[model samples]
Target: MIKVLIADDQELIRQSLQIVLNSRQDMTVTDVAADGQEVIRCVRKNVPDVILMDVRMPKMDGVQCTKIIKESYPQIKIIILTTFDDDEYVYNALKYGASGYMLKGVSMDELVGAITTVYNGWAMINPDIAAKVLRFFSQMAQADDTISVREKDMEELTRTEWKIIAQVEKGASNKEIAKNLNLSEGTVRNYLSTILNKLDLRDRTQLAIWAVQTNVRKRVET
Candidate 1:
């Protein structure tokens, strides 16, 4: 089961999210925190597999919390949740190692899928926010050049592993990856763990960013 932590200052939001997430047999909300400082304390105690972080919180904001959490506990996945769509906030959150980002209005099913998707080592961004991110990158590319690691690291992937990586780049869940690859879910998980090790990456955030940076999808197109 995937252990999750809910960190939103709003009591109703936290309780509602907890209720919805608890209904999933494969996931459980292991703890809840009201602020970033509480987030740090709760994480130290439980070490959850995923953290649903709210952007605007007392004491410390989500981006700063994400930086600290990722720096100290690289294994734990973080997904930023907020009502705001500020580009700077989203960019900083991703730069600091958040694996996923979504608006608070996201449906319960999408939220659950995102949690599981990130837990299994993949990155996710809401389609609306993804468009913004793409636009930001487009403008930034015209201003300055950036060098990124090539996805050729993925060429080292086995034929089966390659299939898994392709689906992950598409933001598919492990179950979805299993369906597409005709492999068991456990096999998909194993492939992801191997992929991370082979790439010498920290987690799915690095993998996804590297995929886009290296144009892994385009390489496959060719």
Candidate 2:
């Protein structure tokens, strides 16, 4: 069962989400928080597998909370579920290791699916904002002159590593990567750990962003 934590300042939002999430057999609401501070408190008590975070909150916003939580507990997956569609929020939340970003307007089914997807170690961006994110990343990549340098620096990566990276850029989970590459899941996990260490990336979200920024698959194809 997927353990979930709902963090929203509004009482109705938190209570309503708890109700719906707890009703699902595969999921349970571990706890609910009124704000970012409370979210941190609850997490310290018993860390949940997934967190549905709201962007604007008293004391600390979701973006800052995401950064702190990921820095301290990188294993915990967070999904930014907010009413805001601001680009800075999107960029910062993702940069700070959020695995999923969905607007509050999303259906409960989509939210549940995102939680499962992120728990399994894959990204889930709302389709409404995915194009915007890609465009933003494209611009960010253009301004980043060091991407080529990073590419050259990664020359020691094995062929298997490159294939795994290509699969990651496609948002494949470890299971999918294992099946696609004809490797065991354990082997895939080991490869991922090695790749993260080699590139100094904290998590899969960063790896995927780096892949896009560097057009990694094109290099693999060539």
Candidate 3:
């Protein structure tokens, strides 16, 4: 079962998430916290597999909480739940190793799917905010022209892997990539894993940034 910790200042939101998540047979709401400090306490007592973190909580905010938790318990996956307007917070959360980001208005089904996806070691970004994330990374990549792509790294990837990277740069999900490439989802995931390892990237977010930096997507498109 995937253990979950919900951290939100709003009691209604916390209780609602607890009820909805606990109803799932595959997941359990292990604990709830009203602030970042309590979240740290709860985590120390019983580490959860996933944390649904609210961005604007009193005391310490979710971004700082994410940084702290990930620094100590790197295995714990965190999904930042916030409004779309909190673009800076979302970017910082991702930089601090948050595994996923979801808008607070996401449906229970989408939340559950995101939780499962992150628990399985994949990153998830809500579609609505994906473009913003891409833009943020693209700008960052442009600012850091020193970030070089070694010729050897380009030569190391197979043609199929390059295609997968192109799809990822376009913000295609694993399922979408699989369908587009006529491959199974599992195969696509495996390819992603291999690609990350070969490129020394931490996750798909970094890979996407690298793709933009290297003009891999543009090259493939043309």
The best candidate in terms of TM-score:
3
Question: Higher-TM-score candidate among 1 and 3?
Answer: 3
Tell me the spans in candidate 3 whose CA falls farther than 4 Å from its real position.
144-150
- TM-score order of candidates, top first: 3, 2, 1
Runs in model 2 deviating more than 4 A are 142-204, 216-222
List the global CA lDDT of all models.
0.79, 0.83, 0.89
How do the predictions measure up, each by TM-score? Answer: 0.72, 0.73, 0.92
Task: Score residue 198 of candidate 1 by CA lDDT.
Answer: 80
lDDT against true structure, model 2: 0.83
lDDT of 1 at 11: 99
Ranking by lDDT: 3, 2, 1
- Pairs of residues at least 3 apart in sequence or in different chains that clash in candidate 1: none
Residues 1-222, candidate 3, lDDT per residue (tens digit)? 999999999999999999999898999998999999999999999899999999998899999999999999999999999897888898888878898989988899999999999998889988777878878778777684324556787789998999999998877888889999999999999999999888777788778778877778777768
What lDDT tens digits, residue by residue, belong to model 2 across residues 1-222?
Answer: 999999999999999999999999999999999888999999999899999999888999999999999989999999998655567786778877899888887889989999998998767777666656766666667775323326555886898998998887666667778999999999998898888878777666677767778787898899
lDDT of 1 by residue, 1-222 (tens): 999999999999999999988998899999999999999999999999999999889999889999999999998989999665567776678878898888889998899989988887777787656656655444444444342444686567886666666665666666777887788999887888898888777666555555555555566666
Give candidate 2's error at residue 101 in angstroms: 0.6
- Top candidate by lDDT: 3
